[model samples]
Target: MNGGDVTEEAGEPVPESLWLATTSSTEYEPLPGDRRVDTAIVGGGIVGLTAAIRLKEAGHEVAVIETGRVVEGVTGHTTAKLTSQHGLRYDRLCSTFGREYARQYATANEAAIDAVERRVEEDGIECDFRRTEAYVYTESRSDGSDLLDETRAARRLGLPASYTETTPLPFDVEGAIRFDEQAEFHPRKYLLALAAAVDGDGSSVFETTRALDIDPGRQPRVTTDRGVVVADQVIVASHFPFFDRGGYFARVHPKRAYLLAVRISGEPPEGMFYSTATPPATIRGAPVDGERLLIVGGQGHEPGLDGPATSERYRRCEAFARERFEVESVEYRWSTHDLSPVDGVPFVGRLGPTTRNVYVGTGFDGWGMTGGIAAGTILADLIVNGSSPWADVFDPNRFTPAASAKALVEDNALVAARFLGDRIRTALAGSGTLPSPGEGTVVRQGGKPVAVSRGEDGELHAVSAVCPHMWCLVEWNDAERTWDCPCHGSRFDPDGTVRSGPALEDLTDRSG
Candidate 1:
């Protein structure tokens, strides 16, 4: 599609989240030369900032290193449902890892909600924080049994779960797993406050400072673009651990999803709604100018696996919204990717086996809203008190063959296939036409793969197609106007700068 076509379809020149556009951003400079702190947290998203705040409460000096603005990473682009009901998770967790694991998972997330509430109340943070019921509903009768099972599992795990056929939705649902006293919030507003709290008082928040590597030892050193941050401990919370010593790239798979904020003709549903359908749809209302605007999200797929179809996810979400609600206009559109663990749980705590003073949190499985905050307390407990009740539950070193073996094997196999298979097709697809405005593609240049694109203004740009993270061929994400590495979900701007996802470094500039 051309630039005009993309604008007409996606409602903007580039996809922007509703939270980002509505909030004011920070002006913190990059790491000013070498720094020293008690703890240096990498990545300025929810997990890093939350952990930084908790450590500060324990009187620890901290510094945060961010590739971009704080809270503008995965934490800024979430569905923002703060609940223990993680999309029918307990049933699968119980079946896979047993009730004990499920209970701890439930407890951490439930307490995550309370943690956010307590912080908001204590700090007087006006982040549009409000309690709402969270639902995982199914529209198909055939899915009711599974939904009922999930409800039973959640309730048994002490989540306030209720099974219901009727809902406050505009359309009908066969059944749903409902949890009471859950919440929806302006995540950026809340975390921005935490970021502010994390700054000053011998603590620091550094933006535009990307952590390139971590040297974990007596004093863990986080090497960054500007300088190094030497600290007593370190936390890698950059969504997809930029430094993957734990082989997280294998245990966790990448899934890309789209989101759109639209104004409806009438009132939206008064709670968070997630459907249990394939590629599961999510609906939640946000306050907009004294009224409410419905945010429709879904149409998920593995990165690079879908090829040219990646751009069509936004259209799919638009169609879903129009078919159900009276979408007056799609006000905002954005896309975000999450790391899904092969197992049901997230990997938190130590960065790897036999590692000390280095912690990592990733594989949130698209529930970073709660998981990120929970990870903060978990990491804080591990750092200050040496252990937490959730230590073993989310231990990065803890591996269960039954829970993770199949997925771990499948994920790596797909990666290996892509690494080989993409190259196999590259030579044939090279010499194709230069991408139209707002589009990009990988082509053969001098017998090597080159990622090339044209801007909205018709200016051409090029970069080496190989991803710095794992050497997987990069693919064009037309909707987001970025090059996405299918293997690790590392995204880069048209100019080759790392936009988000893994890959701590940018794509190689291929200027002639």
Candidate 2:
């Protein structure tokens, strides 16, 4: 395949998302020097860009600092389903957080959909935005009852939901919970417009500027690699808060999922659909040029856990697509990582009780489109009006020990066990021979675990295997060719550059 071909090739040379591949690239200069603004937004994804636009609209000077290009992170890689139907969530929310909180979750998500639609209209962003119905269905008879309960719960909470025995899917589902007037769009296109709107009027967007730390004070200072952003308030909108003072490492668990965009021979389904079954599947249609592509996703697992190879996950999605739909060719393949909150809801306000000036929005699980928008609105309201109606529910400091106790214990225990176990393995294995070209492995070097990779050109590259986030050993990801932290999902390049964070620093190079 040519380098520009959207289709998958033998070596998976183009790991770009469909949205990113189709959209035009835009770049912004890095932060020049120490600057001042009313708010400093770290990260330029859906949440940070939206928050910057909202804050600028509220007449506040805002600056958005991004380590990479805007919207190129998880936002660009998402399936872009703008629906409240998050895999039988209403029933669980009602059971776990009560009906009122469930109602708020529904309301907030619905409002977020409205906000996106309104923005597209008001800003004239031709991002292929469209309103469609969304369904959560299951093939298992036992899980059908949960769908029924969720339908009832959603309707009780005033959501536009209904229960049906049939759906637009090719397969016959046991039943489905359908939400009407939901939406989908090209996330990168929409977010790029938002990033554009965030510029001008005393506000700015800076790319390739990584934020190092937040100097908390009366005026919080966001220290960046190039300069500093002194502001009255700061929003940690990075997918995982880079500054981890709020203990987000324990509150959220990261999972990676694969997505494949394939040209289908048959007519694509009209509605967005998600499965409630184990090893969940999500199906939706995306219009690329004049053609509609079937976007099939979902084969989630913790990053760096060696099971089936990552390429195997993409193959699984392709196999599923071929089984259900008449697949012609896979147009694109990509992977994204999301943070799942222990409490089943995102944290979207102040970082903590004491850290009032710094706020964070994280743990959207796999439903960041609506969650990110809602978080941006909540953060904007809090920064401007000093409060929001939904503040208490999404407060980062709000403790619901009973709500997340099991998850908290289980997740952190896994982290601790993995950390100690990886160290023990490295210690026992001792130094070994270097990997062949186009491969990576961890070996003991100088009594320390060293991550070594041989590039395609046959040059050896080595770095410390220990993650800067919490000192957990990072395992090499064969599919993405990066070192992914099993603990908090921090990823680094083969030569030790930071790819994603919770870890602000690059891996220590030990190649020499």
Candidate 3:
């Protein structure tokens, strides 16, 4: 669902990302009955769109089926930083995998940035792309050594990295690593331009078309709500793969983070700054309606974490922004979900070991802008040439058991605990009470958990709380007014329609 369509119980508009609010919406018709294409892309975010463009350019017929509007998914909700400076990544990558693999990761991301810039220039896409330095700094004395080590690791790999004592942030810092020639842009605008380019030459982009299943065969078929897209290859770029035959749920952990765009009283930051401190903060500037606003983000936690409510996350971000910068007004606030792989590297190749034709790209770990583009390029090459030089690094089927074993166990354990714990708690709690307007809760009804939410109009809406993806109890996201799965990050509208997936089906309505 679009941000403009979501509202709170008081009938006040829920805060939207500055990107979504500022950009004009574009509409595309859903897939008309059954269709056939050489490739079927299941998502319309940056990854899917870029893959569509690349595949179509390679002379393959492509179709993009999006459950919602193109580019309005996680891509539209991102900080839109096109840098490879994911927090403390290089050091870990070097230690875990090796220096060469880390270098390849860095190279892939650097190439992704260049690819985006090259496309914008060649296509004349007016997406307000701008080049700026990226900084990862720390205020803590303990993190200083980490920052320096990261700089060393990055620079040794030929990345444009240097350790510095200063940053564009208004506050002081102990140390920071600066990566030059990084960039940022309006992601929706760029994707829209690409979507337009993909809408011809026997290729098409479809909105509001949900992919239900993928049938593996010599020629894969993607089953959807309206029809099936029979294609020689399928790419599951839908943030979380809809068809989880490869058991991606066990490999990826989803974290939710908040963002706030505020008008600062003084000059905005000149560069992108990300802090390595606790409760990490990322600061960047966005030109909006002739004035540059400071976008402050980062207060991440797994969904359904017991401590703070969803609104509290935004409030924390707002507080950080106002305290650090002389904020004038908070223009926008939003949250985005990121999928982090057990290992630092993203999974961007064939969906499974034997499933050569079906591909997937995920586990961006909050660096989707670059990761997604890199995935697009890699997937495009794999689909066309049947191989990519980067395939060994990003192979979705490759198992680094020693490195990822602990994470895989821990993440799945948390999921199992949440799943069983929520069910028991709700069973003991029992249902019957109706929450007030703008409130939601899970309670037992006839020995089953029911999700009950009251809207602004005082209408009670109820649905089964179990997520169709993996039977994890869906938690109420008051900020977004949706049921969010804690296990795999599937989200559904209050009325139970699927908003994001891995869960292709709607929550069963049990209000009656």
Candidate 4:
């Protein structure tokens, strides 16, 4: 198997649990008849629901239109560690940007965590919210001096953080950084309660209602396949925003990370843990009725590149977990896609200076728990009050010299590499089917390039391989079962219907 194929190999298979099991939660029912709102939130995830709740409390008529059930997107698969400690980010941010910018980021995240706690208490949500220490360690072979530097920076910013060496890990470490009073919890449970609250007076969440198109005029109008939502403001919180304002697709990169939920027969680790070293490993667990459920996460890659190696990543994590705790069975296996910003901080305000009514909050870089909440607050404040101090820091319009330059070079390079690779494969195949069964690519045949896939039933399905977005080549993402564009981050189903996009057109299934 190629290096990409090894990602799917699981060392110890875990029995599946129904926790966050995703089904067709998209609301396909007809949109609400002739309804208008003060704000229309286009996503039902943490950012959207949180914005809806806040807007309602502000006495504004709010409506949330979701393509699927609330929280079923990236939020459901999060590590659920509510910590401001995002790897070794602070030191890098303070150095590359400025101490002031770094402090703003730290403060925003800390405030977000406090907001979550206050919301939990106010709503009386039974989401198992608990204060725990969060640690980022490195293996003996790796250097985590950056983490120590960040801990110091965090302390300087008045965050409850410090440096440490001791950990409950199985192996020895160089050093570890710890943030005290950080948290962990059941994200879906908390979000479900938030959804319920948002469904109250002045706010309503409509699931299965996908916003097909959005126009940012004096008043924003979101057009779904069935109907339309007319509102004064719009928030694009759909993981990766459907619209590509400020060139977000190029300003950030998309990564797919895997997770394994293992139920161990032994005692649990004391605190939440992660590693800064390459091929990162994150471990966190909680005791449910005396049984410890260890959630192991890591093995991030550029979405479709490591499809074959999916299982091996999980196996390596399972072995690491087994060494420390008696792992019983792997209870859940899933993955999530997150956008990593060029700089460490997320883009959390207006889409761009030109688009006044259009706002966005994305590029969390795997710190979704805290970042999502912060995004909601910043985006909502911009929409309602027209001014926020935090908006200037995260404004998509403010150009980052280092970040934007790095993003342009890095993201474009990946797309070019994939394009050339596809061309080489096509030339080698010549005039025949290149039966690379598990791979998805464009092969030249019958004087045309075709998208070919070997179905599970041993059948060949071929269609036009050209992406509906800018005619880029499409790569098959085995983990998410979708065809993804490497260039601009649009995704499509096997028979495409705009699964995700900057492209509005769906893939026409030519599998005849």
Give lDDT tens digits, candidate 2, residues 452-499: 999889988899999988899998777788888988888899999998
TM-score of each: 0.96, 0.96, 0.96, 0.89
lDDT by residue for model 1 over 125-230, one digit each (tens)? 9989999999889877898888878888888888899988888999877888779999999999999999999999899999988888888777789999899889
Model 1 residue 12 lDDT? Answer: 48
The 0-to-1 C-alpha lDDT of every candidate, in the order given, reads 0.86, 0.87, 0.87, 0.74
Candidate 3 lDDT tens digits, 1-512: 00121121222223898889988888899999999999999999999999999999999999999988998889999999999888888888888878777888899999989998999999999887999999998878888888888999999888999999988788888999999999999999999999999998799999989998889889999999989999999999999888887889889989888988877787798999888766678889999888898888788878765757887667677667666777777778889898989887899998987776799999999999999999999999988898877777788887777678888888888877887888777978757577889888998888788999999999999999999888989998888888899888989999999888888889999978
Candidate 1 segments exceeding 4 Å error = 1-14
lDDT of 4 by residue, 288-407 (tens): 554667888777777535344544555556666666566667777777678887776788888878778888888898897888888888887877788766666677777778656776
Location of the lowest summed lDDT over 10 successive residues in candidate 2: 1-10
Model 2 off-target regions past 4 Å?
Answer: 1-13
Deviation (Å) of 494 in candidate 1: 1.3
* Candidate 3's TM-score: 0.96
Candidate 3's C-alpha runs over 4 A off are: 1-14
| Candidates 1 and 4, the one with greater lDDT | 1
